[model samples]
Every structure is written in structure tokens, then in C-alpha cells.
Target: MFDLIIRNGKLYDGTENPWTRLDIGIVSGKIANIGDLGHEQARIEIDAQGLAVAPGFIDTHVHSDLLCTKPEIHKIKVLQGVTTELLGQDGISVAPVSELTKPLWQKQLKGLNGDIGEWPWHSIDEYLKFLDKSNLAGNVVYLVPHGNIRTLVMGFAGRKATRNEMQQMRELVEEGMRQGAVGVSSGLIYPPNVFADKEELIEICKGAAKYDGCFVVHIRNESHRSLEALDEVIDVARQSGVCLHVSHFKVAGQINRDKYEKALAKMDAGRAEGIEITFDQYPYTAGSTVFHAILPPWMHSGGTSEMLERLKDPVIRQKVKEDFQSNLDYENWVLNCGWENIIIASVSTEKNKRLEGKNVLQLAEIKGVEPADAAFDLLLEENAGVTMVVHWGNEQDVIYGMKHPLQIVSSDGIFGGKPHPRLYGTYPRVLGRFVREKKALTLEQAIRKMSGAPAQLLRLKDRGFLREGYWADIVVFDPDTVLDRSTYEDPLQEPAGIHYVLVNGELTVKDGEYLGTTAGQVIRRKT
Candidate 1:
């Protein structure tokens, strides 16, 4: 008898094809059969009479590197039908740290990646092994972080790598890929990574290319010089021969919204020239990240400790304010969106807990200080551990990105106090608002972007499809009623219409309720 059988479901099969009536029989954690299995016997049966059965959603970009070890928080991903996720996004994550650098990264990344107390692993292999023993809620894959590699070779010094240091960093990249990383990821806007020039990126990318891995990057700039930034990465891919994937592709700011078409044309031209290019984006006009991202790159030169010290100096603060007003060179959130659009999402100190969910303008009035001073004081008080949501774009631009042929879906979710609604509402929001209401994408196209497309990009085999003999990671939801209930104000609310979810042939969510199962496995890149 089959271990489990799902009957009478309209199967989408994770492709851009129309749904078909079918039944799936699961045995020993893989799909044993897919057909008219109405007559089949099973130990358990789920009658998905009106639900759409498709491959489980694969989040292409996420910051769940540390959070995945905590089932209480990570189970929320499965409740929204995410059975697999790609972690180690933005080139900053936990792993491959020396005893000296570990504390620095923990302090710097506290707001972006919530504090997880103490860590046990120092290498990517050790980190992945730790997750294997942590009883994860969903399958996870990782990318070797550029920041970690940089800090390992040279402390977070703001300078280009020497030839010897370059060779060492390249060796580390290959070592991580050999340890089963799917690719290499870098956040060019985040320092030590910001210090890396195009030559450094090309050198490191060649290592990932040697393993046939993709190079996923949060480009240097996403606002005024977004096109130039795009060209830089495209050239890196061309020179290194690594597949390129842009993380959360967007043209931020009100004025830069018109650059969307030009960006797409550039990507199309790159693809036409035989370079593989793809991107993932959340369906939102606003974007979220650490609050310190608003500062000039030079301010973050040495590390978080150095940056905190600079925040204390009045002369440096003046320079910072001047740069905020005039520096169009970096992704200046202050110049493009203003302080009112930057809302504080999370803070590390109890004194600043009340500041969470308030914009800098509001904080300025409450604290009786200028907006820049208020933000700087919070950074100092919280030790650079503050996160913010910046309203940088509009709905029309979001819709346009969704309709792009090479685009995929990823929440880029950051979990903490008053986090972005994308943390809970990304997939259902697309199914409800974009597909059902706005007609921006059909259900088939949306499912493909969430499932098959990411699988193809990551080169994941025997998953992301409903084919026979594949691993039984699946989701059943009502297309007509599936919708995200979470909002920016009530950001913790769960979604609706996700009836069932399975990871590796085990049901984790049944009848819209989480069963608290940890059936997920650590998916490694196959060499």
C-alpha cells in the first residue's frame, strides 16, 4: 500500500500548463505514482476535492539562515506552503567565521538576522551539518556568503584585495562549493563586500563557475546608478562564466521608477548575448533592510564597532548628514525616499523597543531631535542593530516586474519585530491580489515562478515538480480563495486558503493548521 494518497485534485505540476485532474501516491518519501489513482489504497488519504495540488513553493531568496534552526519561527514558512527555501542571501550570513570575526558579524547582523544567542559552527559544512541536526521545518539550500569569505581572508578593511589575498579568497569560494553550496552570493552595498571591486567579484565568481554554480548578487546600487550597477555584474558574469541571478530586482525611488523598462531591456540584451540571467522579486512597492544601510559606505569601513564609534563623533555625524544630502553615488535611501518613508522595523535595545514601527520623522518629533540625529542616536543605542522598511516604489512598477519573463518569486523576508508583511504574505498576496484580482499573472505562471523556475535555476533534481519518483513536496490550496491576510500593521497574521502542505512525504500542514512537523532535509548541490 502507498504511504499516503492525495485524491481528486487539480494538479498544476509546477509548470506553465493548465491544471489536470489527477491523484498522487506517495511511498517512502517520494512520489511513487501519478495518474488516476482513485482505486489505489493507502495508509492515509487526503481528499483534495476542490484544491489545486502543485509542487511546494521554493523561496529563491530569504534571510532564514539563523532562523531555520528555530522551528517555532520557521514553521510559519510551511504554513504559507513554502516547503523549501534558499538561505544565506545578500552575501551576509552565519558560517565560515573565525573566533574573532564571529562576534563582529553577530553584532552587525543582529537586526537583519535576529540574535540566536550562541552559535556552534565555523565553516559552511559545519553550519549545514548543524541544521541537519536541528530538525528543520522545510528543506533548505545555501549560497557561500561573500562577506564571510572576505572577513576570513582579511578583516573588514575597506580596500581592494591583494593578489595573494585574491587567490586565498578564490580558494575559499571553491572550498564552499565543494562543501555543497549551490552558488556564491554577495551584497555589494554591504561592507566589506562594498570594498570589493569588479576585479575581486570576477575572481571569486570564477570559483563558483568552476563548480557550475550560479552567482546571485544584491548589486552595488539599486537607485540612481542601478543600470551601471547591473552592467557591472553582467560583465562579471560574462568574464567569469557564472550564471547570474539578481536578488530582489527593482528600480527604487519615485524618480527612478521609469528606469524599469530600460533595466529589463538591458537584461534581455544580456540574455540575447548568451549570458544566463534571472531575478527574484517580492510583490511590494516598499523594501526592507537594516537601518544602517542609509549611512555612507565609508562610515561602515572597519566594522560595526568602528561604525558605532564614528556615530559618537560630532564631526563624523556632520559629514554623514552632508553625504546623505549630496551622495547620489551610493544607494542613498535618505536622498531618494526621505526620512518619513523610512520606518523603523526592529531594534535591539529595550529603550528603543517603543521606536519599532515608527518612522524616523516620528522618532525625531518624539525624541526632540532632527531626523538624521534621531536615526544616528538609535543606531548608537542599538549598536547598529536596527531594521527599517523604506517605501521606495509604486504598485505599477511592482506589477511590471511581476510580468517580466525572466522574473521569479522570492519574499526576501526578514523576521523580527514589526517585520515586512512579505515575511508572511508573499505567495498568497501574488495568488490573491496579482493573479485573482489584478490579472497581472495567471495562476500557472505564478506557480512556475515560485516552483519550477527556481528549481531550474538552482539545478535541483527530483524536486520542484509533480513527476513520478520525485520527492513528495507538495501544497494544496484553493486558487479562488487563497489570499495573504498579513498587513504592514498586523504583520504577524497568517495567510488563508492553504489547506495542506507536505515535505518529503509527510504532512506538516493539514486543513490550514500547522502540525509542528520537522520533516525537512538539507538539500546539497549535486556535483
Candidate 2:
């Protein structure tokens, strides 16, 4: 008897072709049989009638490196049909961190992943060993964080690396790769990483290239300076001979909405000229991040404590406000702090729970203050530790991004706070809203974007397809019944129509509820 049998499902095999009816059999955590497994008995059997069975979704960009360290994070991610993810996104995560910088890096990103609750490791390999023992619900791969590596070699100073420092940083990256990092990643838009000049990026990328890994970049700017940022990435790929994967490829700001085609053209041209570029984007228009992203980079240079100190100085605070006002669109900026849209998904501090899910704008109006001022005040009150989502992406841009072959989809999901609906909603939204409801893509094409494409990119051996020998990372759902019920107003609601989800041949989520089985492994490079 097989371990489990999923019978009577229409399988979308991630071939970018039509769905085919198939029966899947699993044994010992691998796909044991496909097609006519009709008469075979199994230890467990699932009647997958009227469901579309396909490979479980792989998230190419995520901030879950720190989240997975916590045990509860599994239920939140697995229920969304994510079987694998590319962690250490946007240049902030704990890998390749030195003893001197670990404490500060932990504090700086507390808003993104929450406090590191007694993490014991110091090196990338040690952390991976811990992850293996953590027993996550799905597989995780990492892009060795550029900011973490830079901070390890050079402290959190906003300056270019010296030649000696640069060499040491390169060595650290090589070490991370040897320890199983899939690639190097950076947030040229965030501090410490923002401090690295283009030449520095090129050097680190070259080290990644030695391991045949890609360089995943959150470019310097996404609005006014998007083209320049894209060009810089292209130049890095050209010089370092590393593949480039652009994270959350979007044209932000009202004025830049029309620049999508132009930006895409530049990327296409670079690829034609041998840059080997691919990118990932979310299905939504609004982006989510910490409230601090609006502050000028210089104000955040020394670290979180130093940044808060400057916040107390009237002159510096005023300058910070002016800088934010210059870039922030006042009319559209929603107060994510406490509003109908601002749901508090996770709060490390017990006292802040009362502020959850209320609009920052509404809260500000109640306090007789501006929205920015309210956001600033909330951050200070929370000791510069609050996560917020901005309502600023254009639907046209989201739709436009979906139609691109090179642009795979990712949620950029921030787990804390009443997180944006996209965290739970992105994959299903793409399958249900974009594919089945709107018909932007055929069901076959949609599955390819989520499954086949990302698997090929990440170089997973036999995970993304429906072949007999692949791992049983599968999802079975009804296309007609599939829909993302989660919304900005109620972000925690589970999606509907996903009948069963299996990871490593074990059912982690079955019948739309978590089964509490943790079969996820830390996916490592084979070489």
C-alpha cells in the first residue's frame, strides 16, 4: 500500500499546457505513482473529486527567514498553499552575521520579523542547522543577505567598504554559498545596503557567480529612479557574470504608472544583450513595509537607537518630516497604524494590542494630528518597532506585471501586524481572481507562473512538476470554488477551495485546515 493516494483530481502539471486528469500516489515522501493508480490501496486515501491538483506554490521572494525561527509561523504560511519560499529577501535576514553586528541587525529588523527571541547561532551554517531542527511546515531556501554580510565585515556605518573590508565581505559570501545559500540578495533601497556603491554590489555578485547563484536585488529606487536602478542591476550582471533576479518589479507613484512598458523594455533589452535577468512581482498594487521606509536613509544610519534619538530632536525630526512629505503622496497614504485597513496581525508587545486593526488616519484624526505625525508618534511610542502596509500600488501595474512571462509572482508578505491581505491572498488571488475570474491567463499558464517557473529558477530537482519521481508537494482545489476571501479589512481569513495540501509526501493542510504535520526541510544547493 502507498502512504497516501489522491484520486479523481484534474492535475495542472505546471507544463504551461492544459490540465489532465490523474491519480497521484505517494510513498516515503516522494511521488510513487501517477496516472492509473486506480486499483491500488493506500494507508490514507483522499477523494479529490472536482479539484485541480498541481505542484504546491513556491514563493520566490519573502522575509520568512526570521519568521520560520518561530514555531507558529508554519500555520500562517502553509494554509496559504506555499510549499517553498526564497527567504532573506530585501537584504535583511540572519545569515553570515558576525558576533559584533548580530545584536544591532536583530534590533534594526525587529519591525520586519519581530525580535529574535534567543537565537543561538552566529554563522550561516549554524543557523541552517537550527532551521533543520525547527520543523517548519514547508521547505525554505535562502538568498544570503547582502546587508547582513556588509554589516558583518563593516559595522552599520553608512559608507563604502574599504578594499580590505570588501575582500573580507566577498569571503563571507563564498562561505555562505558553501553553507547552502542559494544566492546573494540586497535591498539597495534600504540603509546599510543603500550605503554600498555600485562597485561594491558588483564584487559581491561576482562571488555569488562563483557558486553559480543568482543575485536577487531590491533596487535602489522604484519610483523616480527605477530605470537607473534597473540599469545598475544590469551592469552588475554584466560585470559579475551572475544571473539577476529583480524583487517586486513594479513602477510605483502616480506619475510613474505609465513607465511599466518602458521599464520592461529596458529589462528585455538587457536580457537580449546577455544579462540573464528574471524578476518577481506581487498581484496587488499596494506595497507593505515598515513605517520607517519613509524616513531619509541618513536618519537611520547609526541604528534603531540612534534613529530614535534623532526623532526626539525637533530640528532633525522636522527635516525628517519634510523629506517624507516630499516623497510621500499625502492624499493616498493610508495610516496603517490603526484603521479598518490596519489590522494588527502580530504584536510582540502586549500593550500595543489595543491599537491593532484601526486606521492610522482614523487614529490621527482622533488625536487631532496629521497622519504622518501619528505614524511617527506610534513608532516612537513603540520604540521604532511597528510594521505597516502602504496602500499605493496601481491595479493596472499589477495586471500588467502578471501578463509578463519573466515576472513570477511573490507576496512580499510581512507576517506581523494585521498584515496586508496579500500575504494570505496573493497566490489564490492570482489563481482565482486573475486566472479563473478575470481570465488574464489560462489555468495552465497560471500554474506555470506559480509552480513550474519558480522551480526551474530555484533549480529544484523534481519538485515543481507532476512526474512520478517528484516530491509530493501538491495542492488540490476547485478552480470554480477557489477564491481569496481575505481582504485588507479582514486579512487573517483563510482562503476557500483548497481541499488538500501535501509537503514532502505528508499532509500538512487537509480539507482547508492545518493538519499540524511539519515535513518541511531546509532546501539546499546540490553542488
Candidate that scores best on lDDT: 1
Backbone clashes in each candidate structure, one number apiece?
0, 14
**What lDDT does candidate 2 reach at residue 474?**
91
Q: Where's the lowest-lDDT run of ten residues in candidate 1? A: 252-261
* Best candidate according to TM-score: 1
Q: What is candidate 2's lDDT per residue for 1-527, written digit by digit as tens?
A: 99999999898888787878789999999999997889999999999888889999899987787777564664666777889988888888877666678888777788787665866888888988889998788989988889898888777787889888888888888888999988899988677888888889988988899988989988887776678788999999999999899998987666767677888988899889988888998888767777666677787687777888887787887776666545432222332112334423444466876666666667677668876667677778877677766555578778877888887878788887678888888888888999988888888888888889888777788888888899999988889988888887788877887878899999988889988788899998769
Give residue 229's error in model 2 in angstroms.
Answer: 1.2
Per-residue C-alpha lDDT of model 1 across residues 1-527, encoded as one tens digit per residue: 99999999999988789999989999999999999987789998999998899999999999898888888988789988999999888889897899999998998888988877898989999999999998798999999999999999999999999988988999999999999899999999998899999999999999999998999999999998999999999999999999999999999887887788899999999999999999999999889999999998998899989999999999999999999999998999999999999999998888878988899999999999999999999998888888999999989988998999899999999999899999999999999999999999999999999999999999998899999989999999999899999888889999999999999999999999989899999999997
| Model 1 steric clash pairs | none
